[model samples]
Target: MSPIIENFEKSVNTLLLVSTLVATVTFAGAFTVPGGYNSPGKGFYIFVICDSIAMYSSIIAAVALIWAQLGDVTLLLDALHLAVPFLGVALSMMSMTFTAGLFLAVNKLR
Candidate 1:
């Protein structure tokens, strides 16, 4: 591969590693923090669930990227594997919005 392609692959792999570490740390923090889930706000729950899913997805994508690199998968397959985490992020944002609305509705009812 050309120097440019090699550099790009290195950068992508580094990003995947960093993202996986961050997700792991965040998940650990969620467990360690007190009152992490006691809030009356639905947004908190939504965020927690979203974060959990996003973290797992990121970890999966990172592993998939490593597999692709080792197994000489097609570039398109590698790209698709890398792109999955962004979808998780998008879904997390949607969950945040829906959770906020749900909390507001519940509060109004009470």
Candidate 2:
């Protein structure tokens, strides 16, 4: 492997781990919803939407990372570019999901 590819491998490994974790957590969050199913407020809807987005985006990023493993320089670069942005989107959405879930949970106490 070239030095460039080797460098990318390290990054790919890190990103793959992150995307996988985000996907798993978001998938779980989808089921164990905050405020329960009985009360569907704005925060509940926001949590649902953001959780779905985070889960799907992270799954896509994981797929892209798998593609990056093909070992072709051009393909690896393309896949990395695609995966990184999706990973970022997944992470941001995950944060939004957490905030929304918190809001829903806290609001339920009022």
Candidate 3:
């Protein structure tokens, strides 16, 4: 195979792994909400929104990267282009979710 295709495969694999991990973490976050569900607040709501965004974006990224795994060069390039931004969004939203969750938890402790 060409070097370009080899590189694409490696990148796709790495991105797929990252997207999967982000989705998994965010999915888990949804269940064990900070400060519990009994006392809903702005921070809690933010956490939920951000977590959902992160999860969905990562899932989308994973799907796109999967498309890249198909043996077409043009399709691989297009899918890689699409997946990268979604992965970035997912990572950013995951950070926001963590921050919001931390804020909620800390406020609860205080």
Candidate 4:
């Protein structure tokens, strides 16, 4: 295989591993915390479910990216599959980070 392909495979593998670990940790944390999702409140469970879905989708996307990098399919097809969940993960992470940062900034200003 070409050096470029080898490097791409390595990078995709690394990303897949990292994303899988992060997803696992996030899911575990969400489940372990009391009232994290089990609270008798509005939308708590829904939020937890959505977070879980996002994390899982990220992991799946990472796996697909790695598989594509390993030369499983045409480059275009692989890219298309990878792009969908890559965007999903990116959007989810950015939204969560921005929300947390905004909350912290507002709290500090108060």
Q: TM-score per candidate, in order?
A: 0.58, 0.95, 0.96, 0.57
Residue-by-residue lDDT tens digits, candidate 1, 1-110: 76766765775677667657656655664464323355646466665665566666666666665665663537635654564565456346444534544564465464
Model 2 residue runs over 4 Å out of place are none
Model 4: runs farther than 4 Å from truth? 34-38, 69-84, 87-110
Put down candidate 4 lDDT per residue, 11-102, tens digits, no spaces: 66666666666566656645553333334333344445555665766667666765666465476357545745674674476356434434
RMSD per prediction, one decimal?
5.6, 0.9, 0.8, 5.1
Candidate 3's TM-score reads 0.96
lDDT of 3 by residue, 1-110 (tens): 99978988999999999999999999999999988998678898899999999999999999999988888999999999999999999999999999999998899463
Clash pairs (backbone) in predicted model 3: none
| Backbone clash numbers for all candidates listed | 0, 0, 0, 0
Residue-level lDDT tens digits of model 2 in 1-58 = 6787899988988899999999999999999998898877788889999999999999
lDDT of 2 at 6: 94
Alpha-carbon shift of residue 3 in model 2 (angstroms)? 1.9
Each candidate's lDDT (Cα)?
Answer: 0.57, 0.91, 0.95, 0.56
Assess the local accuracy of residue 9 in candidate 4 as a C-alpha lDDT between 0 and 100: 64
| Candidate 4 backbone collisions, by pair | none
